[model samples]
Target: MTTFLTGWGRTAPTPAVLTRPRSVEELCELIGAAPGRGVVARGLGRSYGDAAQNAGGLVLDCTGLDGWTFDEGSGLVTASGGVSLHELMTALVPRGWFVPVSPGTRHVTVGGAVAADVHGKNHHRDSSFGAHVRSLTLVTADGTARTLRPGDPLFQATVGGMGLTGVIAEATFGCVPIETSLMRVDVERTADLDETLATMAATDDRYRYTVAWIDLLAQGRRMGRSVLTRGDHAARTDEKEPPAFAPGALVRAPAWAPGGLLNGLSVRAFNEVWYRKAPRRRTIVQGIAPFFHPLDFVDGWNRMYGSRGFVQYQFVVPFGAEETLRGIVGALSAHGTVSFLTVLKRFGPGSGGLLSFPMPGWTLALDIPVGQRGLAGLLRGFDRRVAEAGGRVYLAKDSRLHADMMAAMYPELERWRQIREQADPAGLFRSDLARRLRL
Candidate 1:
């Protein structure tokens, strides 16, 4: 059927022929009969940009291929491409197992996790999702399914290749064994950006997960003021058996909302309240969902940005490039950028995924509604600064990055491209992101 699709940001809607493949055989058949424009796999539409979109072409909705099995002895799971993290969590949490790495949302599919090589709050300790993958099955452009393991060039290329190498059919990955679904969390507020960075750097190793909510609107003495939270999974005790793993959505965003609803004035107020409401030095036990995927509590929350949609800008700079991070944060504050959600986290190291985003550095992500004044030029300026500082933006969340900057930001881009080209000589796997970035 001809369907219009957009990423989670809800921007740049485009039409395509969307179909669901029930199994690997059906997926191969669809790929064999693909149209001139090529094809790409999409799962849950959690990608904030066009990475999963194939404009005016065939889009294989892989959600139908959701078969999976687990081995309790090894804490390993072999799941098909379309199974979502939420589904795994719903089933595994009660069984005392947790996904090794989870992004901000649990709705992402396992295939999407491998394609993006996603990271989360525990990245300072555990690394990305691809790091836990023991092996993966990919159906390449020639319709041959290949089983790839770590250390292989093709494996490294495909892990974070953004579905460009091929369709991820299935994967075997290790999962973390948790004694309980609850997390023992510590909450604290940072006076400014310097303290935020210093505090996290000083004590990061003590906690398995850590992140800060930066108030981007704050300036002068308050510039980069933040609320920091750090935690590790709670250990089993006489706590009346672990609770069930059901996460409920408290509310849904309206189908329609007016633009300019998240302007500077409103965001500042919300940030102020949110920051003040946080406990100064409190340690509490929080549910797994609240600790890891709080945003999932609201269905279609992206609509809160209204018809203009939003742009999720995520980039990482090396450990020594604190100046670059400061400059960018200062610029955003000076512009009074209306960003309701701005997060900062520290990364330990990069997985071998050549195209994977995370590296030993500091990463920041912001959600800014589209149509913000000078948004394009401001971000373009950031792109230049990031490239010069030896930093790279996350491809999964990128929509407006210039094609020329890709190679400069990712030093191994050429290598990744070579492997991708070899795996899919016909370039059968294509997406709007690839076309726009000239990949």
Candidate 2:
């Protein structure tokens, strides 16, 4: 019965009971006999917030169920809920197959990815994790296991239902075929907001993966200055015998980095260097590990934000609403918020999953140090602006979104709720986030 708090940026929960079940039968027993009326499944605890925390209820840590089998003929991989993408990639990459979709980090589990319906830079071309899912095995509140497929309405609801629907025990999804574990990448720099948007709009479709590194400290004429990166799976001939597996090369950060070390001064300097260092026109061949999971190179890196931790603010704005994008970036620059990681991307079509986050729009994500005065209020204001424009926030990365804002942002909320209720009629499967957001 080991207990651990979630990732940075969330208030710690004092769960009445926490259990790590190594098998589905054990998981069922724990759920059936829990003292509390509510329960939730927690994966790698990488959600950056309380979405996976069950304060007074039962919290099931599913990491022990790491099991997976691949069907080489069909290129389909069925994995246990606890298998992390890092592990999956290590196994599949050498075989010339890649996860259909992956978020920025590789430390997340299959269950967490599906529960959040995670997306990546390729979203503008491939949609989300849910889009690749073919089937899943879920454990309902009554301790019953049900296998569901894409056509099942309950399947869509559970895909991004934030674990309130049930415990995702196993999942099967299609994998993308790759010629090599290397990427043929193109890099470009944009001098201002207009150029950045124009470049992304004009060229996003030319590549399978696209993202922008925004200079959050830039102001006035230089506002929204960015470095755009576009890439696709490299052809075998593009590189000489793909880079060999070198797990030892992954570096981990020190246990502690001084608080306020990443303040305005340091961030501005770093952003300047990054913007200037990026080449206006360049093509390079790089390995998949560095390209997809840059942050994962450093272990325990979250400790750098001091004990208070940090929150990742990720929101989307529709295609035509350039004003919303400009306004948000301008506001952040005005405040001089210390955000070390600021990313911008264009999303294409969206999946019909009731709570899925992405759509045909531009999305911005930032990692801001916590406890900044009025930070919560500022994000709330941003939520309003997003909702007003028919946009929504990603629930996977949210920690402080209000219930009303959530309802306003997601018009399909009621439909998801109905399906969830039908699956867990007694409202037994729950979490602090579900209660807080009234989901």
Point to the candidate with the largest lDDT. 1
User: Can you tell me which runs of candidate 1 are displaced by over 4 Å?
Assistant: none
Q: What is the C-alpha local distance difference test score of candidate 2?
A: 0.86
Q: List the residue pairs that clash in candidate 1.
A: none
Clashes of 2: 0
TM-score of 2: 0.97
True lDDT of residue 169, candidate 2: 95
Model 2 Cα shift for residue 420 (angstroms): 0.9
What's the lDDT for all of these models? 0.93, 0.86
Q: How many steric overlaps are in each model, in order?
A: 0, 0
Top-TM-score candidate index: 1
lDDT of 2 by residue, 314-368 (tens): 9998898889888888998887777999999999888778898998899999999
| Candidate 1, run of 10 with poorest lDDT | 235-244
Tell me how candidate 1 scores on lDDT: 0.93
